[model samples]
Target: MALNDVEEAHVEDREGNRYFVYEHLAQGSPTVTNPTGKETYRHSLAATTVRPDRKGTPYLYTLNLSCRQDLWDDLQPLFKESIDSYRLVPTTSNYIAPDVRPWQFW
Candidate 1:
């Protein structure tokens, strides 16, 4: 689970919640070799929580964006916007989505 070329930074959401961000590249290998292999790409802007619980466990939470290298600049903003709009919710079974995205309740 090693991440290559790791770089870390900080980011903040509109409501003032701040997070630690990290960017890195990852490569995968198949259990069996094949004539055709998978391609690797750049992944970036992973924002996570810095503070852990009192138990000393790490509280890592992040959103990742993956796209064609050529489209990174074009699509990065949209991915960041979606990540910024994230809102935490209760894990109870009775929760429901707002009318805007009601189908999510299904």
Candidate 2:
């Protein structure tokens, strides 16, 4: 998908974990129409972070949210709250055994 009017920033959450955030606008297919008879468009927000797991393997974590462009102003605060609450829980199963191939495990 393509995004327009993109803005990006580096931010930290409440726990001081860093994240890269992107805010942009996305236009849906013109062939599809919403109930309002207008082409659909959305305000999209994405936040991503990379952190190591128990075995020191890094993984990318992302949070994405979208709302109708017209409702973005009203929903922005809620989206921020949700993103601020994001936390990574390190787990033992996050890594693969050195002797095993990824496909073999599945």
Note the Cα lDDT for every prediction shown: 0.54, 0.71
Candidate 2 off by > 4 Å: 13-16, 30-39, 93-106
Residue pairs with backbone atoms closer than 3 Å in model 1 (clashes):
none
Model 2: colliding residue pairs: none
Candidate number achieving the greatest TM-score relative to the actual structure = 2
lDDT of 2 by residue, 9-103 (tens): 66766465777777778775443347553467888787888876556776677888998888999999999888767775544655554344545
**CA lDDT of 94 in candidate 2?**
50
Residue-by-residue lDDT tens digits, candidate 1, 1-106:
3534565555665344566565555543332443232544455656565433344544444567665444678987987776666544423555442433545743
